[model samples]
Target: MNDLDKVESILFSQEKRFRLVDIPGAGRGLISTSLIQPGDIILRDKPVILGPGVAEDGTYCSGCGDISGSNLNLMENCSCGLRFCSVSCKQSWHTEEECRIVSSIPEPKPNQNYWLITLRGLVSEDPRIGFLQELTVQEGAGRSKEEDEVVKLLSSFGFKEKSILTVYRQLTANTFRRGRGRGLCAGVAMVNHSCSPNSRVWWDESGSLVLSARVKITPGDEITLTYCSPLLGQPSRRNKLLQSKGFICRCPRCQDGTELGTYMSSIRCTKCKPGLICPVGLDEDKLGWICSSCGFKPNPEKVSGLLKKVEDELYGLEKEKDPGRKLLLIQQYIEKNKKLFSSDHFLQLRAGDLMVGLMNKLAPSTSCIQTKEYYTRQTLKVLETLDPGLSRFKGFQLFKLYQILFEKIVHSAQGSLKAEEQFQLVQDMQTSLLESKFLLSGDRFAPPEIVENANLLVRALNQEQVEQIQDKINQKYKIVKSVYQCI
Candidate 1:
């Protein structure tokens, strides 16, 4: 066997389920031996590396891992018993409790326990703090040399007694959560670097984290997970991940404008038209574009300026008072540029999303035949290109489509539907909900209330339709659960 084959076998044999595989074009990546379907379990691992806990120090807030004290105290402890900078950050941690209790526990070493004791004693004396006393009693009973090293490490990182206690609490709680597992996973140890990754890392409901193929995987694919959520487009995604994770990703998707046939980085050719024609650049590697027809070239500054103007216009329209006027402007802009920019283009997609939002807002309440049919047609056209399983807007759009069709039936049939129409509507709603559930899975940004509402709607649908919706929800749930388990 070749070296890569040997490595792959070793990684996926009975001894191991995963390993880093070398790819020709891509860098080193993780791979799975077994065929993993849409929502199959992959791996459940933890962090092999961790950073210092600065939350409980009162010097740093646990909410966003930000050191800022303002509004930091408002954050509650996470399920893992650690504090985060905010509720959003806490949810991201996927832990059970704030690490306050863990922080109060004594270190399992001779001198180290002294700091733990100090923090615990202070917490105990405060009327507001009886929740962590249990942990204090547990830590006071035993000590270990390893605990000493950890404490010394924390001290070196400038952690005081309060923050040190918090760190200890976080560790202890995570350890307990691990049951019998060893240290964190090597995969999770690899820094998250890109959004449109060749690979994806996910967590399940049970808290296992798993790594899997976000796209197709070959024997030598380098696996990657976006540090930031994938919902954000390329520019914003890259900037945020780089700033927070401290790494600039050179992944194929990040480097090249083409992925899944979408030109994510194209800019309009200003010379061709005042605000319309976009000329595709020489792939994504060579800087600047050579116009296909005119041989005109745009400097980077010009391209950037064009993009800025478009963005500014979009922003201005977002605040416009008249939805109809906004929609008309957007439609005109889209129509003007349709030949130059395909629907898949990022700018065009944004425009389409705005149009969908406007349509939803302006649709007649009772069912105007013309408006209802018009929106249904528009929504279907968009869905042809957009993955209903990925876009949040897709679900709402589908919901609106169904609403329109229902309104049409009501208006024509005088508030009653033929058995066939009823069956068709049920089928459509079920399909839409199923797609939406998958799209919504593992989306931390989507409020739990919204999910619950969607689930309730699914439940109220026809019995035959229920199975399809449940299946989709379960499939996504499994994928998420496996990701958590692997984590």
Candidate 2:
């Protein structure tokens, strides 16, 4: 059978909701065969061949590919000289037969780390590895120096040149990191990419990759996942895709210069108070920007320099490694650059997210609470346009907003507020809690602890228990009422 036919046969056996179909310009992609609702579990597939992802230092276990116990000097007893966490792992993952195969070959040199996964594919009798031949194999220009060494090593072991190249490229394109290791899932590998995807893939508690709907998808609609982070702006997203995935995204979001009205990459224009500067066209590398309200066009080099400087400063802050200091640095950063970019620019949005976690770590202040609330709302507004409808990002943000609101209400002086105003705050917090709970309920990426916390918070703040909850929080803080009166 042809590649498409073979892929179809494999996917059909696993999932009935979607079918493999040839897409123009996109090669092969999965399409929904029936209506799929937001948050529906679409596909769950275990990796066909699991192994350590590309690591040059050989720090991971050969059996389970975990790096945790590598530092404990665990590889000494292994027959094949590969790292294994325990005797069970050595016996189970690197069996005598596999050991014989590994021992026969010369030890690969430094920087030839990609050889490990390719060798695993070649020697294993797994039927799923054979299915990988039907997948696309990228080569030529982007092949790394290490991969060239891999090709020579496989040739010396007498594997065919064609088979070696196919598996090498397949592993490069399709492998998904599951915790400490990486694996290739045949069915999951076929799902294509989009900046604004209708679906997302997450590794479950059992280590299986689960694909779920992010929005309502009708029959015949193509299913996609963002190979890169959804939080990135257009230029960064496209550049990442081109460098890593070997294609430029022409998705709807990438095509629109305004990024579907979120203005994620736009800057505030200095020449016009009410105007924002946006790209004139959809070129991913274009540096020119045009003002929306005025006819002014900024120098491309000037804009690039300013953006680079801001990015460098943020990068420096990220390396701080101390949460308290990092929080302070980001506050200073936002204060410095808040007027340069639009409120919803990706940099601001990302910094806002970082601040959320940092604020939770340190003591809460009235100013911190208000800042957190503003950033949360701004981030939610952008996600509404980019991801929308039961996405994990939006759900997580909603949960955080609920937490911040709960803190605000708890720290407020109960006796000072009018009855109706107090009721409104409670109503808003409850709505956020309910929405977050619904959105994150079945999400594989949502931590069990987070879900449980949401449920517990809901029970704690139930309308009948509000007064008791307030009393408990007030007691826990043990601060004077006047300190909280500012909230």
Candidate 3:
């Protein structure tokens, strides 16, 4: 059988809803054989080969591959110099035989985890290596200093240069970053990329890669994943795709200058305040933008310079430790960029995200609260357009909105609120909570507090304790409304 056929045989041995097929332009991709609903598990795969990515620095456990903060530097006492969380993991995955082999290396480096991982795959007689060999090599892009060091170290161990290069290339091309490291999952590696993808993949606590449908997939649809951040605009996304994945994405979102009507890449026109200047063509490398009104095109360098400045500011804001300082800088940034970028621009969305997070720490006036609400709602709207169904991003944003609504209800309860107004806010809170809970279900990437808070709120809503608060408020107002205000 062919390599893809072998991969299919290995994958189909497990429960899967998709089949591997070659498309015209996009080499090999997975196609759904059956209708797949959002949140449905498309595939659950364990890594055949697991190792550190470029510059990972041995932060993850060698055995069981757990990268949680608590597991770091746990047991560096192994003769092989591999890290392990416990004795059981050391015994289970990193065996005495493997340790002996690793220890026998002529001159091992401090962080030889990359070399060790490549060594395992190189020396192994496992049948899966045949399928792995079919993966693309990271060639012609020039190697990093780390990669060169890895090759030299492996060569010292007396392995063939050809075999070493082959294994190294396959690992680099096909691996997905689980945490501080990457893993080569044969089935998942075959699925191609899209800026807006139908499927999402995350590594579970058990070290298994869980691939689920982010949106509904009818039969014959190609299963795709985003290789880069979905929040990035076309230029950044395209640049990332080309540099890393070896292709420029012409995905539907990438082709559209307006970024699917969200104006994620568009800047507001200076000549006509109402108009947005957007890219004119499909060429990601070329600089061509035209305003929808007044036919004005700003200098490309000027646009790039502005974006770079804002990007640098955002980067600095992200690194700032103090929430208060971060909030101040973000407010300053919003005021500075308001005239330049459209309200729904990706940069603004990022700032909105930062601002939404700061809401928990700072006490704002009623106007500030309303502004936060506006940003939250706009962010949620943009996310819905970018990632439609069961998105982890949307789930977090929903939780933020839920927090805002909850706080608004509490604040209004202190004052005299119209029973109907209070009831609407409570309804919005429950909806956001429940929706977030459902979206965040089985998602390991979501923060623990978000999941916990969502569950708590859902339970409280179910018990109707907040409903009691609403009744008290309603009685005080003496209005015939089944008002549901949070206490």
Candidate 4:
């Protein structure tokens, strides 16, 4: 049997949520074998070979690379002085023959994870070596240059150049920045990238790669993951993908300048109402931008200059020392950019992010409770559009939203408010708390401070609030049961 076929068999044999299939327009991709729901961790895969990244140099779990203080033990180092979180992790890293060889090399240099992964893929007795051979590497323009340098490194490990190159391509394309460096997850890596992806990936508490459905996936749907940060605007996402992964994105979002009606790439037209701007189907190139209403085509050079100037101003505001002026400047910037980048635009979302930072600094003060809530709500909306369903970003936003509602109580004397206002506040608080809990449940990558603060907030809620939320949750369960029966 071919090496890749052998590896696929092992993967298929163990997989439960999804299976490998050749998609029509795409090549080999992960297809949902059964229904997958939002927030459900459909798959969890361990890394094939993991270590510190090119820039990272620290004692992380040799097993999971968790550096966030998970009670890691310094019992023993790999032969090369790498620390482990536990005995199990240490044992796991000290692999049969492959990792022993890795440890024997005393104190591997930075960026050696690539070599380590290639070596393990070649010589490891496991079938993952065969699977690693199957991943496609971008090999057109710059491939010729890297080929020679990589081959030299391969030769040092006493392996055939062909085998090494095959694994190298797969590793470069598929490896995630995990385990302190580079982590190769066999099943998770099988999912390809899409700008508007249906799946989102995260790290579980134990550091396993968890893939969750961001949207409903019925039988036989192709599962996809985003390679670049989806939070960035279209131009930025496209630029990053082209530079890093060596591919021009033709995703639906990329082809349309409006970016699914978000107007993220639109320009500010001073002549139009609200001075709105958009790209024109101008001159035959169709690449030129113009006002949506006024049809004002801008010089591309001037557009770039304007964007740079605004970004530079934002940077200055970010570094501003005075908190109150920083917030005022942030609000002023948002007011200006709302015309440039619509409220839903990623740049505006970034403005929301800055306001969240501002809100946090003034969270204890009663003077701006309403303002804090407004920015928190606005930021939550933006995150919903960009990074939807079971994201650390969403979790933090929800947690912040919860804090804003709870702060009304803290700010008030004896937690007093009008009767209707109290009910509305309670309902909003319940919704935010429930969502934040669901989003962050089992999320290991969530900041410890956020997690702890969220916990404290939930605990601070009185018995009456807890009871109201629980009753509503029970009612929801009953409704779901009834709907299921009817279906």
What lDDT tens digits, residue by residue, belong to model 4 across residues 105-160? Answer: 54544344335556655665666645643433445544545556666765665778
Q: Give per-model CA RMSD.
A: 13.1, 8.3, 6.9, 5.5
What is the per-residue lDDT of model 3 for residues 1-487, given as tens digits with 9 covering 90 to 100?
A: 8867877987657877888988878887899999886667888888776655555544567754555356575555587666777787666556555677678765544465566667767766666666653333236656656567767777766877767777776776677876566777777887888878888888777767888887678999999998777788856666566655667677888777888888888888988868999866666455568897778988877877777777878988988998888888998988888888888888888887788778766785676678779898988888778875556677778877888888788777775678888878887887777666556666666657766775576566645755554455335323334322223
TM-score of each: 0.50, 0.78, 0.81, 0.74
> After best superposition, candidate 4 residue 117: deviation in angstroms?
5.2
C-alpha RMSD between model 2 and the true structure: 8.3
Candidates ranked by TM-score: 3, 2, 4, 1
Highest-TM-score candidate: 3
Candidate 2 lDDT by residue in tens digits, 180-277: 67778888888888888998777776767888777778999999987777778856676567665667778888877688888898888889897888
Model 1, range 143-213, lDDT digits (tens) per residue? 34444555564564345645555535423322111211212233343323444554444444444455544
Candidate 4: pairs in clash? 52-181, 53-181, 279-289
Q: What is the lDDT of candidate 3?
A: 0.72
- lDDT of each structure? 0.46, 0.73, 0.72, 0.64
